[model samples]
Target chain A: DAGVTQSPTHLIKTRGQHVTLRCSPISGHKSVSWYQQVLGQGPQFIFQYYEKEERGRGNFPDRFSARQFPNYSSELNVNALLLGDSALYLCASSLERDTEAFFGQGTRLTVV
Target chain B: SQELEQSPQSLIVQEGKNLTINCTSSKTLYGLYWYKQKYGEGLIFLMMLQKGGEEKSHEKITAKLDEKKQQSSLHITASQPSHAGIYLCGADLGGSSNTGKLIFGQGTTLQVKP
Candidate 1:
């Protein structure tokens, strides 16, 4: 089966602009989570959605938000982007909550 | 303070040698996960440990969890170029519910020389 898949493998946005990244979880998976990885650092959790409900949220600002669809796909949106937002946005999916999660290739966002 | 701490920010070892990396948590860990990532890429799941003193191995890699001490270690025997990458430890902090929210360490970058 195909692993978690993400769209727009690369993106470039200007400061104050908004951007949306997409992720399609593996078949049969129900939980999706988003993470941001800065250069030379490990990923930081942003949001987690299980069964289409917001299960958990990280310490990110209000500019970051995400939601999961009935089919288990997810979208991550960043508003009023800042240069600090330039990083790798990763999407992970698991069979259920607290299970082993598979990650996508990630969308590299570059804020100019 | 960082919730998770990984030792040896980076490692450079010759092939055929063995190396070990550690992850220490300040808070209790309900579950500990190990993942590998290439630079600027996504993470690849390696192993997960839930029980105290539990150890698991795959190929030449072995991981052990010590719940009492809130520490975990990853050891690789006969390291190869393929083993080179950024090793990260992610943990689900102990709480009333398992939200699947993982807080990760700064990561340990490993470089193997042939």
Candidate 2:
């Protein structure tokens, strides 16, 4: 079991630029959710996708979006980034809506 | 705004001691979950309490939810260095329109020194 895998372990971008982080869910899992964790804070839910369709969205602005691919991989895209966007982007996978979740190491995004 | 509030913001204990962290929510939760996170790491789900007055135990940790449905506590017995981490409590509202979306507390950082 490789667990959930997130790409671009760390990234740096300037304000107003756009960045896309990716995640590969655990094998045999079909639900993926994105969360943003600022320093010294608990992660805040962002978006959720299951079976290639969006299941739910959090309080994040419209500038943040995500999509789950047919193969159960997910991509989180953030546009018009601000310094506040600098945080750890976490991806969690679940077998289905009814089960517990497994999280990845997360992608650290630093916006200057 | 976060409806959930966690207590003691941080705590330090000697190895082998016991520690308790608390979580309180303004709205009734259909479910409450506890998670542990090491420094700069992802969250590890510890336990989930769904019904009021529910209690669950896992290894050295025990979690209890009050009958009022407004508060919960996580108690770790014989804490070890491996148990040092941030403890977070989250609530699932289980609204008619949403089920899994959770509201998290600020988290309590636990440090166990040998």
Candidate 3:
């Protein structure tokens, strides 16, 4: 079975610009969550969606937003990108809560 | 706030040696998960411990959840080059977080020398 997949393996943008990262969850997976992983640190939770609904959100600023598609795919949008927003944006999918999660290769964003 | 904290932010061990990584959470977690990631790659789930005092093993890796359910440990037996990576511990606060919104620790990077 194919695992989670992400688009635009790498991206570059200037400050104050906007970017969108896409994610396709594993087959039959109903949950999709987004995380931001800066260098030398762990991934920070951003948003989580289940059954096409916004289930939870993290402590990110209003610049970060996300949505889930009917097919369980997800998109993470970052507005007014800052250099600090440059990190590996990871998308993880799980069958359900407390279940093992599969991750995508992630979108590496670089803000100049 | 960061609810989970990991120890030994980084470690170096010789090949065939054993090492253990610890993770502690400010709040009791409903589920604790261990994941490993190679530089520039995605994370791979190692194990998940839900109930307190639970233990599980996979190949050379073993994990245990403390009875208090606020702490967990990952022990790698006979560490190898393949085990050289960043190990992250994630905790799920049982609440409305059914979407697998896990809170992760800062991570411990293990370097094994041959």
Candidate 4:
């Protein structure tokens, strides 16, 4: 079975621009979450969705938002990106809430 | 705010030696998870422990949850090059955190010298 899959593997955007990262959860998985991992740091939780509903959000600013689809896929959107937003954006999926999560390869975003 | 702290931020051990990394949380952990990652890559799940005093092992890697449920340790025996990576511990914030939000530690980087 395929694990969580992310799109574009790598991207480059300028400050004040917007970027959208996509993730497709594994088959049979119902929960999807997003995390931001800066260099030399651990992944920080962003948003989590289950059954197409927002279940949890982290300390990120309002500029960072995400939503889940009925099909269990997810998209993370960042508006007016800043240089600090440049990092590896990871997507993880689990069988259910509070369960072990499997991660995707992640999308590397670089803002200049 | 909940925080996870890992000890010995970095380690370099001989290939045949053993090493242990610890993860501690400010709050009691409802669930503790171990994951490994290479630089610039996604996390690879290792194991998960929920009950206090619980212990689990996979291959040469072993993980244990403390009785207080606020700490976890990962031990690797006869380490190999393949085990060289950043080990991270994540804690589940139970109660209002029904979404399975995991707070991760800063991570411990392990390097095995052959």
True contacts kept of each: 0.68, 0.45, 0.69, 0.61
Tens digits of lDDT, candidate 3, A49-88: 9889988899999999999998999999999999999999
DockQ of 3: 0.68
Q: Give the CA lDDT, 0 to 100, for residue B19 in model 2.
A: 93
TM-score quality measure for candidate 2: 0.94
Q: What is candidate 2's lDDT per residue for A8-42, written digit by digit as tens?
A: 89999999999999999999998898999999998
Poorest 10 consecutive residues by lDDT, candidate 3 chain B:
B91-100
Tens-digit per-residue lDDT, B1-114, candidate 1: 788999999999999999999999877778889999999888999998888899999999999999584899999999999999999999888552252588899999999999
lDDT of 1 at B12: 99
Expressed as tens digits, the lDDT of each residue in A26-74 for candidate 4 is: 9989999999999888899999999999988999999999998889999
What TM-score goes with each of the models? 0.97, 0.94, 0.96, 0.97
Provide the lowest-lDDT 10-residue window in model 1 chain A. Answer: A93-102
Q: The CA-based lDDT of model 3 is what?
A: 0.91
TM-score of 1: 0.97
Docking class of predicted structure 1: medium
Q: Compare candidates 1 and 4 on DockQ and give the better one.
A: 1
lDDT of each: 0.92, 0.88, 0.91, 0.91
Per-residue CA lDDT of candidate 2, range B2-65, in tens?
A: 6889998999999999999999988787678899998788888899887789999999999999
> Predictions ranked by DockQ, top down?
1, 3, 4, 2
DockQ of 1: 0.69
TM-score of chain A of each: 0.98, 0.98, 0.98, 0.98
Question: By the TM-score metric, which is better: model 2 or model 4?
Answer: 4
